[model samples]
Target: MGLIDHLKARLGPARGKVSDLAQQHGDKVQHGLDKAAKAVDEKTKGKYSNRIHTGTDKAKGAMDRLAHKDEPGTEGGGGSGGGDMFTPPRTPPPTS
Candidate 1:
């Protein structure tokens, strides 16, 4: 098997376990993220407040997806995948 395939196969079980743990401790994880963000912002004197909030939101979104919280027919389902992370932002056309 290819390296990527082998890695996926080996990590499959671990993924499920992590999903379960995420589901169980998601709130705690989110709380900790918020706390850390606050601490960082304080240390930086709010210089990176916007970036810190954005990063924290992205992290929480990832955790939710890892927990399958957006899967339909499941508890707490119906949330989106927080959009495509790889998609580039659209820019307005330049005026002539």
Candidate 2:
């Protein structure tokens, strides 16, 4: 196997553990992101509210992806060496 494959083999457990943790603590992580964004918005007197909100949403989406990275049928199977098909839903644009 190549170096990348070797590393993946070695780190598979760690990656799974991280994904589990992310799934378990996803809400807390998203909450912290929101809190930080709120603080920044406050500091900036709401001048950057739109940008901050957009960023916060993006961050939450990333967290969700990470948390679900190891879920079965999502892009790759759940460590079972089987290929399962899963597609994420697209988010609609925010309405004014």
Candidate 3:
């Protein structure tokens, strides 16, 4: 098989496992993401608050897409493997 095909073959099961985990424990995963971001923000003394917020939001959006992959009306806008639901993106902080 070609390299891309070989990699996809190897990673296919992993993607399914991730989708299953995302399905089962998505909330906990998102919570952990938030907690980790908060810790990082605290350590940085809020200096990167904007970036941190943006990153956290992106992470959460990916998680949401993963958790809603198979549901109706979410195709082409979610994880290629699976998904749960949609969430509106948070507004980015205005830069000076």
Candidate 4:
């Protein structure tokens, strides 16, 4: 096997463990993100509110991805390479 495959084989269990921890504590992680975002937003006096919100959303989404990454048959589970690129749209595309 190639180096990448070898490394993945070695680290697969550890990655699964990490994913389990993330799933168990996802709410705490999200709470921390919210607290930090609020602090930054307050300090900036809402000047960067939009940017902060976007970042916060991205962070939460990442946490969701991590937490759900190990479920059997779900997208992002070990095996298929198609999970990372497919996500349902959260909002309708803007009309011209």
Candidate 5:
């Protein structure tokens, strides 16, 4: 197998564990993220507070997605179910 495949094979279990933990403690994770952002914002004197908040929000969103990856109807593309990791999300065509 290629290097990427070998690495994925080794890390698959770790990724699954992370997903399970994300699902189990998602609220706590989000809370911790908010607390950290608040601490950093205070330390920075609100200079980068907006950016920090944005990043924190994105991180939380990503965590939520990972936590819900196996739930029905949670796919980014609204997929039916069950596919490999590389399935492409369907996109709508642009209006003229």
Candidate 6:
């Protein structure tokens, strides 16, 4: 197997453990994120309020996905379910 595949195989169990922990403590994790976001916003005097909120929301979404919150058998069920890592959206090339 390739290096990437071998690394993935080694880390699969760790990933599963992390997912289980995320599932169990998702609420707490989200709350902490909100708290941190609020602190940063306050520190910046709301200068980046919108961006801060957007980042916080993205973090929460990531946590939810990690917990498999949208998948069947978990709370808030009903999703095709994805266990893949986060893939950022690509940007279009700028016109000259």
C-alpha lDDT score of every prediction, in listed order = 0.79, 0.76, 0.79, 0.79, 0.78, 0.78
**Ten contiguous residues minimizing lDDT sum, candidate 5:** 79-88
Which lDDT tens digits does candidate 2 get at residues 4-84?
A: 999999999998888888889999999999999999999999998987987787677667777777666754445433222
Sort by TM-score, best first: 1, 6, 5, 3, 4, 2
TM-score of each: 0.74, 0.65, 0.72, 0.70, 0.73, 0.73
* Tens-digit lDDT string for candidate 5 (8-95): 9999999889989999999999999999999999999999887797678668767876787787786675543333334355365469
Off by over 4 Å in 4: 76-96
Cα-based RMSD of the predictions, in order?
A: 5.5, 7.3, 5.4, 6.2, 8.2, 5.4
User: Which tens-of-lDDT digit does each residue in 1-96 have in candidate 1?
Assistant: 599999999998888889999989999999999999999999999998987987898788788787774356544534554563443654655699
TM-score of predicted structure 2 = 0.65
RMSD, candidate 3, Å: 5.4
After TM-score superposition, the amount by which residue 67's alpha carbon in candidate 4 deviates from its true location, in angstroms, is 1.1
Better of 1 and 2 by TM-score: 1
Task: Give me the runs in candidate 1 sitting further than 4 Å from their true place.
Answer: 69-96
Better of 2 and 5 by lDDT: 5
Off by over 4 Å in 3: 78-96
TM-score of 5: 0.73
Q: Candidate 5: which stretches are off by over 4 Å? A: 79-96
Q: Cα deviation of 8 in candidate 6 (Å)?
A: 0.9
Candidate 3 structure quality by residue, lDDT tens digits, 1-96: 599999999999898788788899999999999999999999999999988997888788788776776667767654443322344556766799
lDDT of 6 by residue, 4-96 (tens): 999999998998888899989999999999999999999999998987986787788788778884356754543435432344764654689
Query: Which pairs of residues clash in candidate 1, taking residues 3 or more apart in a chain or in different chains?
Result: none
Question: Against the hidden true structure, what lDDT does model 5 obtain?
Answer: 0.78
TM-score of 6: 0.73
Q: Tell me which residue pairs clash in candidate 3.
A: 66-83, 67-83, 67-84, 68-83, 68-84, 69-82, 69-83
